[model samples]
Target: MAQPLQPAEPPKARAFEAIVDHIERQVLSGELNPGEHLPGERELVTAFQVSRSSVREAMRVLESNGMIASRPGDPRGAVILAPTSGPLQKVISRLAQASASSLADLLIYRMTLESSANSLAATRRTEADLLQLEKAMARMRAARAQGQEAFSKADLDFHDVVANASGHALLRISAEAVRDSIEQLIAASIEQSPDDHALMQRTIDHHDQVFQAIRDQDAHLAEHLARSSLFEYYGHLLAKDEQIALSALASFGSNTR
Candidate 1:
């Protein structure tokens, strides 16, 4: 006769995760800083009361998050990294592509993020921020004669400056990720336009108006112009329902501002 079946065991938390959590707390609390080396593996094993393998696993996690780096054949521990949005942006763009997110979805998200960023920049931007914006605008103007690709890059740079001026790190990172992910779409839109010259001029004029509004510290006008510019450029690509929704947003911006 067979013995009674055993119950399935519940999954246990990995020992490495505890080490990861401890080190993450240290970094968050300012105990660890960029360019500083982590304690050696032996020290981490002793401190976390875990095996060497667990300590190694913890290091791997931190490295993947761009929080630390290690050199091969070096006895020194992993170096703490200055935080950057690069890893976050890569992950977001990858997920969007993997999930087959649509161009319309990307545009809608951009419109929302940029409009908010413009509004925030109107109030929070410093003189240096305004200088950056003007520099980007100047670059765009200079790039116009260089062709569509150059103009597009400068155009993106301008948006990046505006996003950075919003005084919100999350907004800046998200906007940059979304914009980078849609480079092909933007290029296609330019290539497919009936009149490339007209399109380029419209883009420059829109940026000029939005920048002026931001410089003037007119939050409502800045937001309205930002949203309107996006709608004007990408509205035709959107579904009828989306166009209707965005139109309502533009109307709201006009009345509210």
Candidate 2:
């Protein structure tokens, strides 16, 4: 017996998404550039052959992703924004807060990414890059007497400098996202440590060693020091098995570099 063929399901309606994709392609293709103004909503609606609502929705999505900025009462439509890691930071931070497992994963990912960034920074850093690193270290040292909050900010700044020195956009963005995701956890750990001053001093000393390795252009040492510092600071938070796995990966990254 031949059964009647089932009717195929209709495709999903995603007009706004299509519009968003079109704009993104244009921007990526360099047809639209940062600081350039997008066409007015009506123009986009006509060009995309979609409704005004669809065009508006697409613009909102783009704005949320840091791709464009819209001001109220501006007849010039939205301004194209230079891409930034802000959206990545927000997404990573949200995911890390979603579960203990996610936080653990974030830490492992950061260890790998940061070690690579340190290695690259060591090999590629310029005089300006070294100066930035030194300034960040100075801030860390100065903040030691102030308290954990100040020190933590300086520590983050130092890592930012190291990531920037790598001159890899993806690495810099990923490092920033991971750092933001774990920042609160790091601060809480510092606050709960029995000897805050000792911990702070240890951090400053670790930074100094990493700074020296970068200055001397010792890629392997810089990578090893960065990984070791991270593991030393955060190993207590991980389960025994996870800690062992992360340590192994850190060794692999340092050795392979």
Candidate 3:
């Protein structure tokens, strides 16, 4: 019988991608700890048996992903960075501002994440967590006279605490990413409000109410408040269709509230 020829494998676009995968796997597997330096380019090139250009390209990709930081004039190559939501926030903001439908999608995601996070925060928050939330509230109250910028920072601090108290790391991470994206998207617009002080006060009051609900362990109320208050703050910026899509979330647990 004649020998059969097997099908050829697909071609890779570049050798650098393989290098990228190797470095990412090391980081992910904990073999490469945060703050550790990656092997110098010459070392990487020799180990991977690829050109220095390929190694450099892989470093570029990793740096852009927020996985590592490259210091100029440093012989240490790239340094590993602890994982963070910064990249997620950037991507989310980009997509949310792309179109009306995309904005609606992001809003929907925020609603779902916040509602679940608030509910869990209500059920699972510890005294220390509550103290953090109170600290955030105090900052917001103090920042009220300062300006929207300060108040906004304090506002984010409050939700970050709520997200942490959820006791779900993934939820907390995603919620923080989504919250950052949403805040960045609307911050300039919010600053343009005719009644800036009223808007700021309302924000503080709504957060206060949500905090009380969580303190009481009223999961339903906390969830409802999170969804409803978010909608109230940003719903007007959305089109009518988008509003209709999000209104259900705001009202979903109203009976319990």
Candidate 4:
């Protein structure tokens, strides 16, 4: 009656995914530290009872996901890597460019991230952080005649300082990831603008407000300003309906509007 156990089902877990998950769990759980070595390929192959190719595939996933450094034929095995935003940024950039809806999605996510980062910066910034912000702003002003490339770098530097000042690593990383994802779109707008100098000047002026909010430790105001500034800079690219939806997210009150 058991029908010969219905011919035992194959294991649902894929061999390579098992290997990847095992290592990732160890890394996340702190059993494996950054710069620590993963077991040798031959050893992993034996331990997992999987083929050498499975082990190599696992290594590829780990490296691509920013979890390790692997090189074929390296006797040292794969070294654990410190966390980074690079992989996340790549994924976001890919998705943002995939469709108009995705573009809107990324813009909203970016605005939310910047608002939170600015709020945190207001509450958490150290004197050193403010100094960095000031330096970045000064670079922005000086880069006026240096062209969009330099000004863009300076502008990014200012945001980077705010992200760093937030004192939240994941927040900083995610904000950077999202910012970088849509940077190309923003850059293209700047490049095509008839009055790029006026555009940069307006940006500098808005950033001055942000810098003052952080200096004054005005968290809500800082958050509101951050979102508003981003909306003004990029909202035109979105459809009118999308812009309307975002305006609510961007404004704190009529004052910000």
Candidate 5:
């Protein structure tokens, strides 16, 4: 009689994942730092005892996470960066183009962040910070009167200035990173929709409220105002989305005739 065969166990990971793990260990061990150039592909292959294709695949993983930047022109072609939210933002932007996410989702995240920033600013804002905020707001008002190009630039400047004024480096960097990623989308949406006027008015009003709260040293009021403004924007977006869907349905009916 023949002996029975034993069942095979599942593998720990796929081949690419194994390569990814090996590189990740190096990163965690302090072997990599921002602006530090990675070894060339052939060198990496030898160092890891892996094939060149595996090395390439591992590089792709790091690049996708904003852990490394490939600068082919530089003598040091593959420089590492401290990981940032940039990779997540880039992926989100691409997905948003396919309607995998909505503008509302982005707005929601901003609402959560900016409301906290408002509270912090109420307690922490210095005279210099207030001056910066006032200057940015003035620029926005002037740009709004001029046209879209100026308006967009000023809009970015105002938000960036406000974020910086909160005295939180991490918060400012995160907000700016997301803003950089989706700025084109934001401009497009504002231009295409009648919601532009509504948005601008709300922005102006909330900005004034936030500024006043900070000047008064009222953290609670600032947070409340920020949350209220976000909710109002959310409602406007919801109504606009419904109207768009209805219009599309009517158009489809007409086309079928």
Candidate 6:
């Protein structure tokens, strides 16, 4: 008796990936440039021979990474956008919310990355970086005269400049990731009340000290200040959390009585 030959197994289905692969190839191959509009959903469906839903999902993935943007009712609205770190912040925030990671983990991550950035920035900062840092510091002072909310943005910008001046894109990326991910928690945890004027002044003073360390090219002092700032900030957050828990317990005991 003769044995029959069987056909080889078919390749695994990559239904979702087909659209991704096509878009990525076009972008990499220079067919898609910044500000160029991509084909609409119906056109993509016909061109890729994939379902409309698949194309839409792929577009969303691209959108999240700042590859393209779609607006309502315009045929050419699905245009390419120049990618920026803002999209990275959005992605990081979404991931944090979805994963339910704790604030402590985020602070730990920031400490590790920012300490290294501070050490590097001490040696690597340019004159332009120093000017930028000074501008941000001035903005912080002006914001304080206006209000806390005004100051908060300048405070955040100062940290961003420091990270950027480190001359390490990865450090900038990591710092933004942690900060964006825990932004909501930070907002809820840290308060800047009028009564806390002295605390705010101390924060500004410490920032100046760190800035001077970097300006002087004192890497060791820069690193120490960066790490100490993070540790102190994390301690404040933990203390607040404990205070809330104790308040809740006290309320519960009163209710039971």
Pairs of colliding residues, candidate 5 = none
TM-score-sorted candidate list, best first: 3, 2, 4, 1, 6, 5
| Residue-pair clashes per candidate | 0, 0, 0, 0, 0, 0
What clash count does candidate 1 reach? Answer: 0
* Pairs with steric clashes in candidate 1: none
Predicted candidate 4 versus true structure: per-residue lDDT over 1-257, tens digit per residue: 56565647776778999999989899889999998999898999989999999998999999989999977687888999988889889888888887668657987898889889999999999999989999999999999999989998999889889999999889888988988877765665644669989989999999999999999998888998888887887788888899999888887643742
lDDT of 6: 0.73
Query: What are the per-residue Cα lDDT tens digits for candidate 5 across 18-74?
Result: 866766676778876677888887787777787778778878887887777787777
Candidate 1 lDDT by residue in tens digits, 1-257: 99988769956679998788888899989999889998899888888888999998999998998899998877989999987767866775676666543666777777788889999999999999999999999999899899889998999899889988998878887787777776645556544778777788889999998899899999998888877887777777767887888777765668654
Candidate 2 TM-score over all chains jointly:
0.85
TM-score of 5: 0.65
Please provide TM-scores, in order, for all candidate models, with all chains considered together: 0.79, 0.85, 0.87, 0.84, 0.65, 0.72
Better of 2 and 5 by TM-score: 2
Question: What would the per-residue lDDT of candidate 6 be over residues 1-257, giving only the tens digit for each residue?
Answer: 98887669867656557777777788878888888988788888888788878888888888876788888888764888754567767766676666544665566667678778987999999999999988988887777777667776888898889988999887887787677777766776675556655655777887898789889988877777776676665555555665454333223312211
What is the TM-score (0 to 1) of candidate 6? 0.72
The segments of candidate 2 whose C-alpha lies over 4 angstroms from its true place after superposition are 1-13, 93-100, 184-191, 251-257
On TM-score, who's better, 5 or 6?
Answer: 6
lDDT of 3 by residue, 3-119 (tens): 887659877658999988888999999999999999898988889899988888999999999999999999887999987888888888887888668656777898899999999
Clashing pairs in 2: none
Lowest summed lDDT across 10 adjacent residues in model 1 is found at: 182-191
Error of 6 at 240 (Å): 13
